[model samples]
Structure formats: structure tokens, C-alpha cells
Target: MQGLAQVPRLLLSYAGVQFEDYHYENPDHWFKEDKLHLGLDFPNLPYLVDGEYNITESGAIQRYIIDRWGPAELLGKDAKEKAKLESFLSIFTEIAGAAKGLFFNKEWETAKTAVIEKYRPKLEQLDKFVGENKFVLGYLTLADFVVAEDSHYIERLFPEDFKAFSFLGRIRAEFNDLPQIKKYYEQPKAFKGRFFPEYAAVTIEQ
Candidate 1:
């Protein structure tokens, strides 16, 4: 459970969005109430229940929030910016999706190192794409939020190998430099970093 799930919280916070948060950690029981207001089933742990609409997929959930609450910066102003942002985020999201299965592996028999080597190129591509850019798009936006969350976790898994992809290192440095990104990331209490047990577990293993 990396803070990858906290992307929306950061994006929305940065966009000055304030709303109630409903959580059902590993809600396997599927005990969500009737599909009325925000009609979402609790079966999906991270489902976003927004006024009779429950979006199970993480990307859709995040983008919808941006499209509605943050019509400008979070998404983009014009077609070019929005398209670029979307392409960038889509690629980055794929990287994260592909990396997670390996990054999250508990196997220690050279599997982790092998996985790192395999995904190093993906990380590099991400780095090169975001090189020297203050944000994913022309400015701070949802793309940055998503990538930051993904990298924050991936770095924890392969800090040293991460440096091998110099671009990733740059991206990491960039996010660290952004006061607003850091501030927005730290604003929401429930989605805190370094405190989550998943993070602690990673540390303990390290």
C-alpha cells in the first residue's frame, strides 16, 4: 500500500478541493450500503464514492476529480497541454503498474535486483521525459501528483538502483524541491507518508 493511492488527495489539496473521505481498507466483506449518494461498494478498498457514482479504477477516480474540481491546472487549459499531460501520465502510470509487481516482490534471491535492472530503462525514460520540468505539464498538475506518488514508493524499494536511472534521480530531486508539491503531499493527515505500515515494513526489511 504505497502512498501511490494518495495522488488524488495531493492533487485535490493542491487544487483547493475539500471534501469528506471514506475509507475501507481491504474491505473484503463488501458491506457498502445501498447505491444512493456516492453509491459505491465497499468491496473495493480504494473505490471513490462520489454522489451515487463509484469509480473503482484508480486512474478514472483521480482524473474525474481533476476534471470536476480542478478544470484548469489539474487537467490543463488547452488541447496541447492536456494531451501532453495525458500521454505523459499514461506512460508513467504504465511504468508504475508494470514496476509494482516486481517492486513489491518479497523474494530476495536476486529477484529484486533483477527486477530493478529490467525496469531501469522504464525509470530512465520517465526521468528523461520529466527532465528539468517543474511539473508534468506546463505547470503543476495532476500528472505531477501521480508521478510523484509512484516514484515516492518505487524509490523506497530501490534507492541505490534508482540512482542508476539519473533521470529518476532528477525527478526525485525536482519533487523534493517543489514546496507546493511537498506541502500538498503532507497536507492530508490520513494519507501520510513514512507513517503507513507499508512504509514501515519496507524500512524494517531494509
Candidate 2:
């Protein structure tokens, strides 16, 4: 629901890894269906189902996949690095919480000021952390994927309004410009029934 699958898809593709992506419209009883299918008692998404195993949380899914299929080794070769990678992913799970509240929660519809207030500090901190890094870990890794996914979704939500968040704006540009990620975007294979909200008001900077 947070459009977070972008990171997993792009990471898997960039590393020449193969994975299945499932997409379908929200059923009439969305939460109810999720519980029966994925054991999702809470409303969340961008989950994965591998054969008989059903996984719902994004962090759990990412770590599980990385552990199963080794690539650039975003989880690190040592015990410490692996732990840090998981820690970074956890941080983003929190960061996206604010974005989700603003963009997805209907209860916060008229609370734009409150939403901005919540997001401003988070963005400032992220901007500082991502600075001067060619990619997370100084190479393409899960940490980069963590930030890339959100930047991608944010740009998609309001494609040209990222200037207010300059570092994030640059991150989004770099992500789309990456050759592998560009390829994934060109051939997303998005399921026909995927959600496509009507064009909202989007501002583009010249």
C-alpha cells in the first residue's frame, strides 16, 4: 500500500535476480481477504507470497529474500553489517509511516499542517544521512533500495514537486536514471488490475 515494492523490484532487477510480483485490486473486504490469505491482521501491504509461505511485513520479506538469494550482499558479509542493514531498513519503515499517514490516511485529509510538521524533521535527517554517498554502503545495497523506493513513490505521487526536498529530489532522479532501474520501469509488468488513482494535482518545476 506504500508503493514500497519499488525498492524490492528494483533491487532484485539491478542484481539480475528473479522474483515473482503479484498485483491485484483490493477486494470488497480487503483486510478480511488479507487475513485469510497472508495472516495480515493489520492493514499493510507490498508483501510477498512464496508458494505455501505467506509473508506480510516488508522488512521481513526483504531480509528473507536477501538471505535466500545472495547478490551484492546488502546484508553485509559480517555479523555487524548484517545487523546494521536490518537496522537501516527498520528506520525507513518508520520514515514511511509519516508519508503514508499524509498520503493514504483519510482521517488526516485536512491535517496538512500536522502532516508537514511530522515530515519536515524526518526529511532533514534523511537528507543529512544520504549526503555524499554514491549509494548506501558506498555500493548498491539494501539501504540504497530502502531510500530509492520511497523517493520513487514520492516522485510518482507528485512527480515534479520534489524540489522542496532537494536531496530526495536528487535521489529520485538518480534512481530513475540508473540503467537497471530504468529497465525495470520500462517493463514493470504491472498487473492489469493494479491501483491507478485519478490524476491528482501535480506541479512540475521547469
**Candidate 2 weakest ten by summed lDDT:** 197-206
**Tens digits of per-residue lDDT for model 1, 1-206:** 34445776665666677766645454343444423334455434456666766676677778877777775666777888888788877777776665565544556335567666676776677667766676655466777666656665467667776666554555556665777657755554545534135633234232
lDDT of 2 by residue, 125-202 (tens): 655666666665555567766766565445544334345656665655666688877777677473222222433232
Query: Could you estimate the TM-score for every candidate?
Result: 0.72, 0.68
Error of 1 at 199 (Å): 12
Quote the lDDT for 70 in model 2: 53
**Runs with alpha carbons beyond 4 Å of true place in candidate 2:** 26-45, 77-87, 105-110, 152-165, 188-206
Following a full C-alpha superposition, what root-mean-square deviation does model 2 have from the true structure? Answer: 4.7
Model 1's TM-score against the true structure: 0.72
